[model samples]
Target: MRRDDLYITVPSLFRCPISLDVMKSPVSLCTGVTYDRASIQRWLDSGNNTCPATMQVLQSKEFVPNRTLQRLIQIWSDSVARRQLDAESAAANLSVVPSQEQVKVLVKQLDNNCYSSLEKIVSFAKESEENREFLATMDGFLDTVFDFMRNADSDIKLIEQVVKILDLILSKVSEKKPLLESSCLSTILLVLQRGSLDSQIQSVRLLESIAAVGGESKLKLAEKEGLLTELVKSISKDKDPRLIEASLSCLIAITMPKRVKTKLIQFRTIPELKNLISEPNTSVSTIEKSLKLLETLSSCKEGKAEIWHDSVLLQAVVQKVLKVSSKTTEHAVTILWVVCYLFRDEKAQEAVVSSNGMTKFLLLMQSNCSPAVRQMSADLLKIFRVNSKSCLSSYDTKTTHIMPF
Candidate 1:
């Protein structure tokens, strides 16, 4: 409709009931009342959008000032802004306000959802050419966003997001060198310690990432923090075996081969941990987890020492599993099988001979028992014969990887 038509047709709607004039500000009403722009805008923003006097319903979307009206409002607003700037300039006796280039930069950052564009922002932060102040601001922005992400629930994706946060943190530590020296490193560790089971598990996986990025000093710092032992212990005690298995796998993956033996030995993990491998009656997850821990522990040179150790830890581990009245016979034999295989390794063979481990092997073979026991005895006997430089081969060589799996 034409302005004139609107004016004529809507005269009553425009007039404020109380003032009863030409409705100077084009007052609106609901249920026989009137309100100004501020009140109406407040109501609209709150999702109410109702006229006060007549209680007339209003859809906030319908109140747009079209091209002509908007242009007029902008002209007035620009004049007001210009006057303020002029006044500020005059007070400081300067031609213009100090550059608010910062506002523009922040606007761009907010406009592009730049926070979610993690890699780009992080790489930009790393660039030497970027203004140092700008980098600082960008870091603050990213930190805000990361803090929000840390609130996501404990689903897999949430954990994955935490991993992303951790990776970015690691990247910062790499580039900044002094970054992890701050409280953020401690905070990151705390989050990993307390995150969901899956997140906790991935926290273990981050070991290798940290190893890759963290130099020797930082690595020792990590060790001082006791994170490795904490990670393994968390998995080792988990009721869900897969988590334990994953933890061990990642631990092994991250550990340097040379350091593995010492670390495991320091933790006293050899035989006490090894007993879980042959757990036949347990959930496959449990059995699998035990095997994985064993696998990782055995990957080092000192693992050979367990088989031939004068400590008899290996015999004790196998015996512990055999002693379990809960379906452990197969597991026991499997333990023996693993010991035999390790014995074939020259280091282990030498250790065994030095330790006189052969005496126990002979004893198990001679023990009178069920045929299954005899069969296992014969298997180990054949293995000893084949590998022993001894005259008689007791294991038939057919049943080596033969666990009850």
Candidate 2:
């Protein structure tokens, strides 16, 4: 039993203001304030001169050990640890298993469409990991919830709670085959189209989880009417970073099947994804997913044509190589490779050289990129050397092996 498991409240005097944890070795600065030695040292090392608690500049860097606070913290920790151990021992003796009758009553309440019953169900699921596991094992529990969601008269608030609880239960349950085949998928998709922001986010996450376990169901999800369009619209309209990320992730999952790849292109997903990549404030993870999706889209001729037709999109794709993570660089280079090799667009080749993409490619080869990236960069350089002879001579290269055409 750890001190964190206990319900005891630690005294503020015994805790460090910086770390917010009980101090093992208390120290005081010239400002007449006390902190843990390590915490204050870190604060000072980070170039902060003002005391964290007092906000006063320190006259000196010297600190004196506070033996009194150290003793107090140690005593309190021991007392908390003892209490935690006793609590754990008593809990072990208590049986927390829900009887068969209780399970029947909860299921009945869920089917009754009572708001209080739904609230209790959600509370039971969150009370502990044990309750979640127990709920997953109940027969027809998920089906009952899905049926409630599919019914038209189900209250919006109740549906939102049910979707959230289903999200939780699905995360814990290993067998999600039932969800992929259930009518709930269309209901969730409808929620994605019309539900509130919270419900929309949850619906996207639920779809993402299902897509993770790819099968025929992934293909079915991709073919679902209006699903891809809704996902694209979500990305374009939502300002919340979490919602954008969830939407992008869901798009990536559904597009895994080759049949669905063209569906995204038809929905005009390329321009939206390119816009996201070019956004100055977009997060790194979102950029990575966008790049990955673009890589997938480039596999088809329509994808290639859509990307090459836009010079800004082509330049952005080229500039991404060696600009972000190694994986991102690899994906970026893969997009370029498809354009320059598979599609063989003359303007696209020229755009890469104009964007200083040739320089980035050469630098990528010299850098510590993955072997696949190095090979792809080398292959792209070869294409530039052959097709764009005048552009190749602009860069100064010492190696004769990479001479200008």
Candidate 3:
């Protein structure tokens, strides 16, 4: 057992009051105190007339079998056992390192329906960076994977494995154009919409890789019917933070096109982003990406107008300032600066002031925030200070809060 498992808390009710351990055989004495059979038997044999737990004299020396408690304890123990087994199995799979001969054999045996061999190759690829590079360099590995992908349409299990393997080795593979083919795009779209969470994450990352190869390829990807919709839909679904981050990454890569940005807004990406960043359990990385995506959306006139009108979103953006990592702080500050400082939206400025955003700006000015951020901070502070008629500008500000130019 791992050291951590030693600290796993067993349910108190499942434990023997006398032994302080999970009851192997729970029995209740006449006093209605349940104890492990062995422990209570020893107590009774010691000529004790009282129950160890209750300190009450037994009406009868006989103990009744507690079948219900015993069964409950058994179920709890079995679940813990299964959980430990699954953890051990996963760890074992991660630690397995296959040799080059083993990888080559698996690649040779690969076919459209050969899920096991492909799964093994994927496992090997995931074992280490060295294994991925080695697989990428293999003579027939790419050819075999491509052939399998061609005939594996709608075979979600096969496609999930194939996509994962490809994603693992994609960077090492020199030529990425084949992934842009019609059949391959269809497979990627299918996985994005229907595959398991892991597969969906891989599919989005695959799209990110393809989009990185700019020019006509990026344009072609952006123009794929229903492609942008699915990517935006993934963000709105908010299924997993990993999926949200991956989808945001892909959208950031491909959304340089104005049409794509418009479509994303039409799909309600902004509202979804609002809900995501507002969530307390959201990871810092996801929050950073969410803010970055929001900043991207705010660059457009329509997007800026939409964000400016959502008071809750503006407040959420304000709350993120200096709350998480510096990257998130920067993104959050930039979004605020755009709507409040650049565009001079009164409602947004009031929202910021109401959310204690001025304090964040004051602190940011004196901190190690970047010059651009500092400048934006200065601009926001000026926006509030200069509006003498607004009630928010009445707060006391020390000279130190505003850096001298």
- Compose the digit string of candidate 1's lDDT tens values, residues 65-127: 123333343345445546655664454443222223543354356436544443344333333
Error of 2 at 354 (Å): 0.9
Q: How close is candidate 1 to the true structure, as a TM-score?
A: 0.37
Q: Estimate the overall C-alpha local distance difference test score of candidate 2.
A: 0.77
Better of 1 and 3 by TM-score: 3
TM-score of each model, paired residue for residue? 0.37, 0.68, 0.70
Estimate every model's Cα lDDT from 0 to 1.
0.46, 0.77, 0.81
- Candidate 3 regions exceeding 4 Å error are 1-98, 152-154, 387-405
lDDT for each residue of candidate 3 in 1-405, tens digit (9 for 90 to 100): 573683388899988888898887788998888999889999999999998888998889999878788778867866776777677667656566668798787777665448888777877887789999998988877877776566635478988989999999999988888877877787888888899877899999999999887766667787777788888778752255567889988888887767767878887889989978987767788888888888988888889899989899999999999888999988998899889976899998999999999889889878898877777787788888745653334444333443221
Using TM-score, give the best candidate's number: 3
Number of the top lDDT candidate: 3
Q: Alpha-carbon error at 37 in model 3, in Å?
A: 47
lDDT of 2 by residue, 1-405 (tens): 554557466687887888988786789999889998889999999999999999998889899988667666656866775687687556544534444466569787665656766666766675677778877888888777767766635666777778778877887877776666546676787778768776789989988888888768678777777777888888872245667889988888778677888888999999888888886657788889889888888888889898888889989887777876777787888888788755789888888889998889878768888766666677778777745454334434333343211
lDDT of 3 at 73: 80
